[model samples]
Target: MPPLNDDAIVLRTSDFSETSMVVTFFTRESGKITCLAKGARRLKNPFDTAFDAMNVCRILYYPKSGDVLQLVTEAKLTERFRVDSTVAIYAGFHVVQLLNHFTENFSPQTALFDLTKIILNDILSLNPICRSASLEDPPEKLSRCLLHYELRLLQLVGVAPSLRECVECGEKIEVRRGARRAAFGMREGGVLCPRCRPGKTRVVSLSPEALGALQLLASPEERFWKRLQLSQKTLGEIRGVWNQYLAHQMERPVPIFQWLKR
Candidate 1:
């Protein structure tokens, strides 16, 4: 087939042979693709692209027949996420890893792709503003960006947790004026009201602050997230909820979670 061009974020790269590398990308036009990049292992490769994780580039590749990996002929580095902090860099890794694992090959996820790109840029931009300050404090911008990206990704993929209603009994969650804390059923895929919380397994309790922040994160209005802020305790609660839901959905451990939790 003819060479296809698209903007992509490098997800993972591994040496295929002495002089070639297999590079996986989550692209804007194509969801996720693995391509064999010839001479990619050389000091000065022909593709002229760095296949490092979290790097965004414009790629030109020839699709192979059947199940064969595509051949990437040209990859030009369009953007590199340069962040000084290890926390920032790891946050970016977590974003790309989520995109890599949640998406399917050749399936177009334009909205998710766009969200991933923007979140990466947001994580990168944090370094300049917080250069001297520590991110260990409450109201962490990095945590907010990560949370927003993960929430949007699940929504785009159609597995977003049912926050508005109880998963077990189909009751409205009354998020605005209900109990101070609520139960979230991991397997049931939504919040569980007190009436339906009996004998439930794999559930986590969410504070009112956490639930409100999650609603804002999952809001259709983008400005809600931009103005949203969370305390360290609330961020921890939300992250726990995300971990449980993602674990239930993905059915395996996401390696980046280790670094992200730290």
Candidate 2:
């Protein structure tokens, strides 16, 4: 068909031949795609180092009709993620991993792309006051940003956990104003009422504070960091529970997030 030209975030790249590379990029207009870059390893035209992860570039490629990988004709660097802190850098990597894992190939996912781009810009600036950073601990702020990204990505994919109600019974979750009684089932994918919860195995004890924080972060305010007052314990609980549910959905644990934990 015709050439595809778009802005893309480099997710991964591997050597294909002496002068080319096989690349997987999360494109703004085209979702995730894999293409072969002929002569990309050469420095004469200067595309050699442009395919690194977190680099945004404009690319031109010719598509193959069916399921075969396309041929990337050209790539021009756009924006590079200039990480400012350890947390921002790690968070950037986590965001890339999530997008690669969650996005379907060739699907039009503008929202995911937009969220990913914005976060990349935030983390790269490393401004202690970056919009995503609300806490004094830079790492914690970045970690929460990662969590925020995961929640939104899940929602875009239509499998977001049911935070407001019991996934088993579809009843609204009630926390009695200040009680820490909500239970989150990894398989059920949301908070289960005490009545709906059968047993404790494979479930996460989601406290009221954690629940409230999750709700606030996942709300439509868009500037979620401003609304957060999450304590360390609450952040830990949210991270643990959401990671569990996400792992269940993906049928495997997210590797980058696991590394971030360590």
lDDT, candidate 2, equals 0.77
Model 1, poorest ten-residue lDDT window? Answer: 130-139
TM-score leader: 1
**Candidate 1 residue lDDT tens string, 104-149:** 8889988887888888888878876545554354127777777888
Q: Please, what is the whole-model Cα lDDT of each candidate in the order they appear?
A: 0.82, 0.77
lDDT of 1: 0.82
C-alpha RMSD of each candidate structure in angstroms: 2.1, 3.2
| Alpha carbon deviation, residue 60, candidate 2 (Å) | 1.1
lDDT of 2 by residue, 1-262 (tens): 8998999999988889888889999988888899998888777745756788899999998878667788988889899876565556666777887788887789889888888888787677555644444234445655666677777788988989899988888888865567767888877778888788887568878777778778877764567655566677777777777777877888986665564431
Clashes by residue pair, model 2: none
Residue pairs clashing in model 1 are none
Clashes of 2: 0
Candidate 1: list runs displaced more than 4 Å.
Answer: 129-139, 259-262
